[model samples]
Target: MCSVPLPRRALAGLALAAAAPRLTRAAAAATSLRSTEWEMRTPAGIRHRIQLGWPDALPPAGGYPAMLLLDGQTTYPMAQAVAQPPSGQEPPRDLEAALLVGLTYPEDAFDSGLGVDSRTRDYTLPGPSAPPGAGGVEAFLDFIENHLLPELASRFPLNPDRLALFGHSYGGLCALHAFFTRPALFGTTIAASPSIWWQQGVLLKEEQRFVAALPPGTSRRHLLITVGAREQRSEAELAAMEPRRRERAQSSNMVGRAAAMAERLAGLGAGAPQLEFVSFAGEDHGSVISPAMRRALRFALGR
Candidate 1:
């Protein structure tokens, strides 16, 4: 049989139109999978959003280790996926599942000032510098300590001793603050690019104070510090600036600070939390989260 060919342009247009729906559908499915959200009420009658990721089925024996991730709206999905067992592969027979719990904020509530407010109000110890009408971290901690923990425990089999806290940037600063001020809050803390420069090196000063006051073997904790190779510039800015501008920028040589912090922690010997430093090559501040999270999960789960 003889056939007549259609014009190339017409054929190309037809092909694209036919594939358009499929491309749209795939995009829609991906969007749906990432849109999951949950809301929990704090003890203070405040509502907070919490995002969760669980394996298809619960582990048979021990309760799973839980990770509390800050900045849920941005980082939760990535962490959740990394924590999941490989596709078509069974979870390790000896390993329990891991749960990722993320804390998110309302869409309109997130702003530069809100970031500062959230961390200052939820992650610090009571102090004079806490912004006016602030210093509510203890109350926020009460919500986590009293309400969130119990609710999670009742809902899922979780190992209280295996809890790990994960945060980045400002959130990372919070995790560090919690580690020192409330040492028992979590078993391990993964501080990825922690803002050690916060409050003009107040955090560093606090760490110094902590080491000085606490007796050896007072508490057990583990800390993991991760930074990107490209973040060195921020450290440079910190070192070059005078004390006044440095404090205003919350700028400090993070690279040096992290190494020094690790060394200081090490001096505390076996009593101090095991401190590990990880640096990713070719990654900048914004791109460091994924690699840092992966390393953190491995460390946290002891995999």
Candidate 2:
């Protein structure tokens, strides 16, 4: 069961200046719509919060499509940036009508800096190298499936068939995990800059299992995989970068691995999931989030 619901408030009014730096503009322009919050206890007894916003207009069909944003503290603010209308221009039709849900920890606000520590436990598969108390993906998913979705369904007119998920970094790894192991949970997925290097490529093992278990015929699915262009650099380019960037670019072969996975997944006969891979030029792992988030919203919410 969940705790009491809080009063709706304007996102612009929140003292989130320290919370989501990327959303400052959105926060300033977001005074038009009221956002709400709810607290729920996960099956594992961890308390988390869900922040929600509704569009000013509903689609002609009524039921709205929703995207669950992992790293909600960060992503939710960015969602505001994308969803809010700019000066003198009407908000884009599709962007204004979609539901935005942010899944975050109980005590966390957009300004919290503790997400890194919290997500290390919430986002990954257990491995020998995993930190103590880490590896709660299964339990977390269960909370979403059993508790969160039902709650959302009860309050909102959701398009049951068009659910989507977005995750980045470790959270991206989590979204990929759901894509492979629980394909029915989400019809579309956006995994940006996934930490495919985690757990010694544990998701590859899941990929093998997913293909082995796929039922005959094309399972209708859409997945977008994105990485920063700098991830795959010529030695000359790497030499020109700062030492830290050169190290990151050399260490994790993100573009190559993501492309390889797309190739292998596409080979699962004609019934496989439709996949799109994109590389954002002039971006790196950390800097890629804003562009990737915009694209993810467009893919998931745009017509």
**lDDT per residue (tens digit) for residues 1-303 in model 2:** 111122222233334222323333354344454356778887656777888765555333546677899989889989866774434457776653666889988654322243346677778888888767677788888888778876766555566567789999888899998888776678788999888878778888888888888743235788888888876788898899999988876767788888888788777767778777888998987889999999998888777
Q: In order, what is each prediction's RMSD in angstroms?
A: 15.1, 7.7
TM-score of each: 0.73, 0.79
TM-score of 2: 0.79
| lDDT per residue (tens digit) for residues 173-225 in model 1 | 77887777766568788999887865556787778878977634344567899
TM-score of 1: 0.73
* Model 2 Cα shift for residue 47 (angstroms): 1.6
Global lDDT of each model? 0.65, 0.74
